[model samples]
Target: MGYSKDAEHVGALGAGQIAKACNNYLHWVHSASNVEALALAKRYGVDAEKMREVLLKSPGDNGTPRNFDRYRFTWHENDIDLVLDLAQDGDLILPMAALTDQLVKPITQGEVVRLLGEESCVYLGQTVAAREAGLDD
Candidate 1:
C-alpha cells in the first residue's frame, strides 16, 4: 500500500521542491493549452465538448480537459513564480513558463469557463480580429 514503485529519489535536499514546481508549471501550461484548443474549435464551428471528447481519446490526451471543471485554479501564481525564480537563479530562460504565468492569471479569474462557453466563439473571433489589427502588440 506504499509508493514503492511510483517513488524515486530525484536528487539531494531541495530537489523535491524543485520537482514539484516543475510539475506545477507543466500542469498550468497544459490546462491553459487545453482551454485555448477548445476555444479554437468552438470558433471554427465545432462543438468544443465533442472536440474534447475526441481529444480525450487521442494521443494528445491529458487529464486537464477531463478534470478542468473541477480544477481549483489557486496557488498557481506562487508555484509559477517559484519556477521562474529558480530558472532566473540558474540563468535560464523559459519563455513558456513566462507565458503560462500570464495565462494562469486569467484562468484563475474564471476566464476559462467563459472561454469555453457558448458565446466563446464571439470572444475568440474578437480576439483574432484584435490580433490581426495589431492591437495585441
Candidate 2:
C-alpha cells in the first residue's frame, strides 16, 4: 500500500487509538530493562539509540500529531515519521484492546530503567494515559 502524504487521506488515527497504540508500545518498551527491550527492538531492526531519540524527542512523546503543540521532545517530521513507520513495521505493538485485559501484567518505564541500570527515555504521554487508566502500575 502506498503511503499518504496528506494527513487528510489517511486522516487522523483518532485520539483513542493513538493513545492505545502509544500506551501499548510504551508499556512494552518500559516493561523490561534496556537490554531486554532493545533486544526486542533490535530483533525488529530498530536502532536502540535511534529509538530512544524518536521516542524521547518525537511528537508522539509530547502530544498528538494533529495538534501543533511544542513538546518536551522537539520533533522533526521526517525523523518522527520514520521511527513510527519502523515501529509499526516491526510488529512491536500490543493489540489495541490490551487495556481491557485484566489478566495482563502492569509494567512501567521506571521499572525498565531500574532493571537495566541505565537511563532510557520512551514516550511518556502514553505513560500519562496508562497512569490515568490505572495501567501504569
Candidate whose lDDT is highest: 1
16 in model 1: Cα distance from truth in Å?
A: 1.1
TM-score for each predicted model, relative to the true structure: 0.76, 0.23
Candidate 2 colliding pairs:
none
Residue 82, candidate 2: C-alpha displacement in angstroms:
36
CA lDDT of every candidate: 0.73, 0.37
Q: Tens-digit lDDT track for model 2 on 22-115? A: 5544433332233344434443445554555465565435322112111222222333344366556777653422432221133333433422
lDDT of 1 by residue, 1-137 (tens): 65446765689998877877887888899987887787666656666767888999998797778867668788888989998999999999999999988876766434555555545533323441112222234
Q: What is the lDDT of residue 78 in candidate 1?
A: 97
The parts of candidate 2 lying over 4 Å away from their true place are 1-40, 63-104, 108-111, 114-137
**Could you give me the TM-score of model 1 versus the true structure?**
0.76
